[model samples]
Target: MDNVISVILGGGRGTRLYPLTKERSKPAVPLAGKYRIIDIPISNCLNSYLNKIYVLTQFNSASLHRHITRAYKFDNFSKGFIEILAANQTIESMDWYQGTADAVRQNLRFFNQPNIDLVLILSGDQLYRMNYQEIIKEHIRTGAEVTVSAIPAERTQAEHLGILKVDEQGRIIDFSEKPKDEKIIDAFSVSPSVFDRHGIKAGDRTLLASMGIYIFNLDVLNTILKETRKSDFGKEIIPDIIKKRRVCAYFFDGYWEDIGTIKSFYEANLKLGSPSPSFDLYDEKAPIYTNPLFLPGSLINSCKISHSIISDGCFINDAEIQNCVIGIRSIIGKNTRIQNSIIMGADYYESASHIRANRFKKIPNIGIGDNSCIEGAIIDKNVHIGENVTIKNANNIEQLDAENYMIRDHIVIVPKGSVIPSNTAI
Candidate 1:
């Protein structure tokens, strides 16, 4: 459990996220106001007391690197360190990583270190709180070459994941990458028990979906890297090698989400505004770690809040905020109304204005004018909304200034420092 080296894959192009991925890697995408995508995995490693970590990233890794340096600075006593292994090709291989396995094969220095027994492979794009200690113990006890962290998902949902099939002894008997064959009874289900508990028919019991998290022995990782000819581990390397190796499955029933697309990112953030979110960050046993900052709790200025997460340095005036996350130093003006939205960083709402938007994290600092109304929009950093602006309507999709601004979920994203004119409608 203690002698483990975690390697997080952070090399996704995030094509579905488009503009959001335009500036940074998928793992660097801004999450829940104050956190980034890579924070989840790093926090897990920190909380689990696993010190040595290597993040494999190449696509837009600048922001990701900066964040890691600031967020994860190891202490002298802990000696645990988080390092970013960005892609750097030379004469031997002058190309970016083609797949997950290729990323690790390029950075073989991780396994070269001493005193590392287990290699923990994880996805940097997921949001969840987990303890790797349990999975490590299972891997060690099983004496298997590889141990995969799996979950029960539905047949339809398994299409988005690497579905698996294991025998009674928990040995991985089959592995398919989003196979569409219905006759395949050994397919993985997203939540078999959930459907069974909810009275839904047992669509597929062999539907063991892989969470892309694996625990491997240091020698096993090195051997796999040497034997593997492909770039990706899941789609190519792992599945190909499983034929001659001992592969087992470790079931994970905790809250896990993959923020790989715009829709998924939006939905995942909205989940935080739920009455009782499935993902709990306040757990004492395994706390999510973040860089400390000095700030007071949120201040509601005679406002009415209905299910929202307000961080420190927020001042909500006599307004109504429902299902929105107000970040630090955000000042909601008097008589303002925000609903089912995300307010991140520093936001300023003037008096008598109302807004309803998803992914409000675009703007690091934004100010809405008085008597204005915005809907279903993604306002970028340092944006200014004039009076009487109509961003979203019944259509729920707006295509404006996309050449200048990035688009996520069809929301009109005003770029940083953008100022909207009066009587404007995006």
Candidate 2:
């Protein structure tokens, strides 16, 4: 692991995520209540002792830069280093990242060092916990030029992922990028006995899909990036390399999700509050790390909270919060009901004097005001919801841009730093 380096690819524009990516990179988006999406892969790398990490981001990278710098810091004596490689224009190459392969090719200078043996390519906007040691060991044992992490997918799910076919020896034979034809999918289906041998129950899925996680031999990566002009790995480089290189698949039977769309992102965040979440953030063996905001515990006065996660430095009074995730420094007034939603909370706590002043001036401070019924909404940071506001989508609208908020997929989203007036109905 010491000789191996990890590169987490921050995705492009992230149009599918929309307003969530309006002001920040996809990786920098907050997760569960306090952690960022980038924390998942970085934490996995740290727990695996792969300390040399480089995060590649392009759009709206200011917040991503801040989070990476503040969250990861190793002692000067250790060789561990976590760095960010942003897109820049130089004399030789004056272009931003066109795709995933292009992003890594742009930062190939870092891999020129002599100590590097392999490169672990990871996606920043994914939720999963895995140990890379097993995959690395399999790569070395099989002498594969590249190893890709693979997982079985159901029929509908297989249409959205890179599907692959492997021989009995676990060597990749062919690949297709999201094949729609049922004949092609069934032709590449692996046997249930193959999954049984690996201690995985085949369940209903038979097709194996690439998890967008790959391990490349240092020399192999350098040669491919130099000779091939492939823009993407899954759609281009991988398909070409499998024919010429010794590519193998490493099966990972765990909870892994690509939080790419607004609906998926919203659902993934809410899943954290479930009684038994598939992905555990509290795993002591592989804990997720984030910027430690040392705030006081939440002070709840006669509030009824059920099946929700409340972060630190919150002041809740007589609120009924159910099936929601409240972020740090959240302030909720009395009789407010928040259900089936995610509140990102405030960046900084407002002083009592300032809140009093706002109240006197008939302005609401950050967070939900009294008697507001918010159902199925995502309230971003620094939002001031006025009193008696009914935020529930009354008409079941799919997409609409209101005065200070946006609705998508029948879910209302109050963007950051928005202010809703008192008694507003939606």
If scored against the real structure, what TM-score would every candidate get? Answer: 0.86, 0.97
The parts of candidate 2 lying over 4 Å away from their true place are 352-362
Query: Residue 239 lDDT in model 1?
Result: 79
User: Which lDDT tens digits does candidate 2 get at residues 1-426?
Assistant: 888999999989988877788889899888888889999999999999899999999999999999999989999899999989999998868999999999999999997678899999999889999998989998898899999999988878777999989887788989989899989888889988777766788888888999999999999999999998889999999999888999999999999999988888889889999899888878999999999989899999999998889999999999999999999889998999999999999889788998999889887888888998999998888888889998898888999987799998888999888888889987
RMSD of each: 5.6, 1.4
Per-residue lDDT of candidate 1, residues 1-426 (tens digit): 457888999866877766667667888766776677788898898788887889988888887898788778867897577888888876757888888888877787756777778889899888888888888877777788999998767666756788877666677877889877776633343345543442435445436688989988778888888875678778887677777889988877678888787667767776787778988766788767665556777777677888777777776677776776655556555556666555554433433323323124322124554445544444444465555555554455534344444445665455545656656665
Candidate 1 Cα misplacement greater than 4 A, ranges: 185-206, 346-365, 398-418
- Pick the lDDT winner: 2
lDDT of 2 at 136: 95
lDDT of each: 0.70, 0.90
Among all windows of 10 consecutive residues in model 1, the one with the lowest summed lDDT is 356-365
